[model samples]
Target: MVVVGGGQAGLAAGYHLRRQGLDFAVLDADPAPGGSWQHMWDSLHLFSPPEHSSLPGRLMPVQPGETYPDAGHVVDYLSDYEKRYDLPVQHGTRVDAVRRDGDSLVVEADTGTWRARAVISATGRWSRPFLPAVPGRSVFTGRQLHTVNYRCPADFADQRVIVVGGGNSGAQIAADLALDGNVDVTWVTQRPPRFLADDIDGRALFDVANARRRALEDGRSDTGGVASLGDIVAVPPVRAARDAGLLYAKPMFARLTADGVRWVDGSQSGADAVIWCTGFRPALAHLVPLNLRGPRGHIPTDGTRALSEPRLHLLGYGDWTGPASATLIGVGRPARDAAREIAQLR
Candidate 1:
């Protein structure tokens, strides 16, 4: 067996695979552990408490004086988890493609090729940041960057900045900049931002998702999950900014101008930089050789198993693969199921 990532999803799969007593290798492109968490902005934090933000069989240690663990804490925990479990993860092995070789699957990586009875592609979306093709985006002369490139608020100090996107990333980055008191920040969204209640966090969100899943499984009326609550969770910093009236959002811009953006209302604001907090798509380019992608650019799946290729499992992409599977707390269940199913097949 082979897992094609070493992030939270891959680690979770490794844990369960170990329990199943399966021989497997987790191939990670990164030279070290921590996966994509190491690339997040400095102030980025999990929306859940440490306990709720843990992987399977291991609780993330509590960070003293923190309500939510920061990205650095998560990176450290993942590093330790790898060592603790002694999972067979080959770091720095970049998987280039996956294709059929006889009855088994061939994983072709920069390191080498490996044939396995089953392949679990847990490569999450952080690698493929989504940038919408807004008009005049190519002509914008000012510094423009995606969330993947952003590091800290200090990098944009004293600059007139605009943040695009209404998701958690946009809210968090805008709040971080507003708290800095040095950057002139404007936040714009396609629609009004929807924030969850102060009491609701990732734990509540996961419960809601589970409830919805149960309802669907029982053939009852579909109960909505987090979307029914709101798009963004009111994390500490975001709530603070909201309370202080520093997180107001304008309508998305009509287009990018040379110096800044022209709003939908025909008003223009000049900005020295624009940070796109746009989300990401699944990083599944390596599976193209399998020729299983649907018209929507997603592989059809029954749970995590690819519909066309039963030997391939796609984990931790999104709700389509498993409910909230992209999140740290939500990924374990699907990962466990995938490992078990693979074991059964063997």
Candidate 2:
């Protein structure tokens, strides 16, 4: 079998696939594992803290007093996971498509093609950042970009900005800028997202996680139509954002004019930058032969019974277990379960 996307979920899945003796291969687009942890902007750290953010069979090194860690720290841990488990993941191999061809599943990438009896799709929603549609997106005169494109806050140290989205990333960016940035930034939201306590351990998804967990457990997919991170549960993003006094109205944007963003109130806000923390979408378009998924764009895989394809499974799906499913703390749970399922296929 082949696992696509080398992020956290993919790495965990690859580790388990090896344990199951399933003759599987992990296909990741990056030069090494570390997943999205490698892509996050600097100064970004895990809200789940070190204790909760650890991977399967791998313990994250202790950080001084800090509960959460930064992207660099996470990358280091992923490297260690590979070394400890000796996971055979093909680095820098991007999977362009996954389709079934009679007897086996064929994975196509610019580098090469891989055939397998089953395929595990781990490309998560966060792999791609979603920017909200605005009226004058092209009119913005200053630098306008998404959180995905952000590498660090140094650029915003002395500028005026507008941040969109009510997710954790938005909140964190606002807090960092307000405190450390050398500039003033305004954060806007289309809707208020919920946040979980920094204690539960994982990434985003708040109260809504409970609801999602119930849905998956019941084998009833649809995740209530894949709402925002806050819709899932109230997590650190909400708590931390409120604590920072940098919150704002939802759905208050009008459009982007050459000057800046036009607010719903007919006021103009000049922004040197705009950040979208709007969350992510699943990358399952390549899984052509799989007749899976519920009403929401999520695959229908419960704790077990990988029924998406004859030999297919999906891992690292957000909020599969409610708040914890997609978090670093929660990924191992599904990885363990999926490992057993893969064994059954053998």
Q: Relative to the unseen true structure, what is the C-alpha lDDT of residue 330 in candidate 2, on a scale of 0 to 100?
A: 69
| Pairs with backbone N, CA or C atoms under 3 Å apart (clashes), candidate 1 | none
Error of 1 at 329 (Å): 1.2
- Candidate 2's residue-wise lDDT over 1-346, tens digit each? 7888777887888788887877878888888668877888877777555766787877788777666677888898888887788777888888888777888889998799998877777877766666667778777888877787877658877788777777667777766666564768787776655654444444333334556766766899747533533332324444554676755545658898886777778888777778776777777777645657666676666553345565777777765422354666667777777777768765
Question: Mind giving the per-residue lDDT tens digits that candidate 1 earns over 179-232?
Answer: 989999999999999999999999999999999989988999978877899889
TM-score of 2: 0.84
Instruction: At residue 60, give the lDDT of candidate 1.
Output: 97
Per-model TM-score versus the true fold? 0.98, 0.84
Best by TM-score: 1
Candidate whose lDDT is highest: 1
